[model samples]
Target chain A: MSHMFRLLETGFNPAVFNMGLDEALLRSVAQGESHPTLRFYGWKPPAVSIGYFQGLHEEIDTDACAAQGVDIVRRITGGGAVFHHYEVTYSIVVPLAHPLARENILDSYRLFLGGIIKGLATLGIPSEFSPINDISTGGKKISGNAQTRKLGCILQHGTILLDVEVDQMFSLLKVPLEKARGKLIADIKSRVTSVKHCLPSAGSEPFESLFSTTVGALEKGFAKSLDLDLQRSEPTLKELEIAAELAAGKFASAAWTALR
Target chain B: MKLELIGKPEGCKLLRLTIEIDATAGLSAMALIQSISIRGDFFAIPEEEFDALERALAGVALGKLGLEFSKLARERGLQCAGISGEGLDEIVHRHLATLNERN
Candidate 1:
């Protein structure tokens, strides 16, 4: 049986607005006003998103982030800090009782990430869904994901790395120990891989085309692998209004970002 | 006493705990937890339930922190990933034992 899904390609948005829109879509799907959704988006001005349970000051160098014109926000989902740049971010919202849902966290990730794995394959990159919220190619991580279940729906969001700038990432994020920063940076460089690095002709292709190219590949990958009838759509006016409020009121608020 | 401890159980992510201990009968008395903030890259579904777990840990004796935390987490049915009650129990108890050695 083919499931119906709303596909929204909301190109670029501020960090708070991006997070708010994801939550807003989750709420709408849970309330039965909209279909389960698969949305692809990008962050404007770049950004750093920390996990819900993480301490803001512990993970981020706010002064550096602001100085570099990067936005910062706390995700409702729990995971490590993520530098949102040179990546194609995707969010999938599905009801708890949906066929794709799993009771076990690891099993849920295995099932939900099948599309990503298949999508990577479509791009000529064979990837596996690494346990505990990651997608890996070979042994290096290519993507990181975070998920939260609320209001009878599961909202899983993640980033697919198109390119990586490990040094810039380290500059924006604080290490566990200042002295170990060099070692940590070296370790991340070895352990992380990206689409541009993996794809044969990706380097020659214009950087601007990577986003659309990857998004298109992923859209087809999800539809074929997940057995979905996806209809192109826009964010409903109600969703946009609610997202704007959430952006200003929750995601952008200091109390919420510094919640831990 | 303000105590900060870091633990990383075999199968869980790094857990950083900033705890305030209130000793009821002076330094030698039973140490009770004034408050605890659990921070890490762990996943707990319906995060509010996890927040409630933080609140529910109040006044729990330092010795029983693990038991109480495990019990409350199980009761709340917070689906967790990268962290576990047993892992937390082992981490807290092990850290305390290390603290005892310092004195």
Candidate 2:
């Protein structure tokens, strides 16, 4: 049997709203108010999002981020910090009772990551799932994901890098002094890659073109990989209202961002 | 003296351990520890429980830090991703041993 999912493409949104929407969707699905959903969106003004367990002061340079006009928010999921620029971020929410939802964390990642692998293949990039939560091509990471189960649903969100900006990223993120050498940065450059790098013809294209192409490919990827019947739609009034409240009270607040 | 150590165990996220120890005392002794803070991009769920583990670790003897951490994880039913109590133990033990060799 094919699963029906709500497909939401919300374009570029601020960090607070983006995180808020994800949490709202997770809660709605858990309460049976919404269908299983797959949302594709981008960050406006760029942003840095840290994991739920991470300490903001230790992971991010606040003054540098503010000076650069970058936003910072903490994710509800658990994983490493990510610089959200030149990327198409995706979030999927499914009930815990879904057959695709596995009990073991690593196994769940492997199952969910297959859609991404298929999506990358559509763009002529052959990728494989690197255990825990990463998708890589030629052994370099192109997508990083994080997951958490909350409100009776599994919420997994990740980014598919459309471009690479290593120097800018390192500037915003803090590295331990010992690992701040040139070699570490060089190693990261070699280890992290982008879709533009994989497809040279599209590398220099406009942002809209790149975004549409990746979004289209990913939609088909999920449909084919998971046998999903995707219904294009917008968020409900209730969801939007909840998202607004969450953005103001939880995601945008200093207390939640600084909570380690 | 204050010491900070970072380690990235295989198949795990980065881990940082900060400790303050008495300079005049032997490195492995129980009384040398003043404070400890463990921070990283690791996941230990029922997330709030991690604070308990971190608090339990404070003032612990250096030699038994790993054992204590492992024991606490078991007691709290910590299911981890990107980290393990034993892996943490190894990093702490190795870091302390390195300091001992240096001093």
Candidate 2 docks at the CAPRI level of acceptable
Overall lDDT per candidate, in order of appearance: 0.88, 0.85
lDDT for each residue of candidate 2 in B1-103, tens digit (9 for 90 to 100): 7777678766557887777876576556454556777777777765667778877787777667667777887898776787776667678778767867988
Which parts of model 1 have CA positions greater than 4 angstroms off? Answer: A177-186, B24-30
Where does candidate 1 clash, by residue pair?
none
Identify the leading candidate in terms of TM-score: 1
The reply for model 2, stretches above 4 Å from the true place, is: A177-186, B1-3, B19-36, B56-60
For model 2, how big is the iRMS in angstroms?
3.0
Q: What is the DockQ of candidate 1?
A: 0.57
Residue range A1-260, candidate 2, lDDT tens digits: 99999999988999999999999999999999999999999999899999988779889999999999999999887788899989999999999898877877788888888898999999999999987789999978999999888777889999999998999998999876444342255565577899998998986799789988999999988888988999999989899899999999999999999986
**DockQ, Cα level, model 2:** 0.47
Clashing pairs in 2: none
lDDT of 2: 0.85
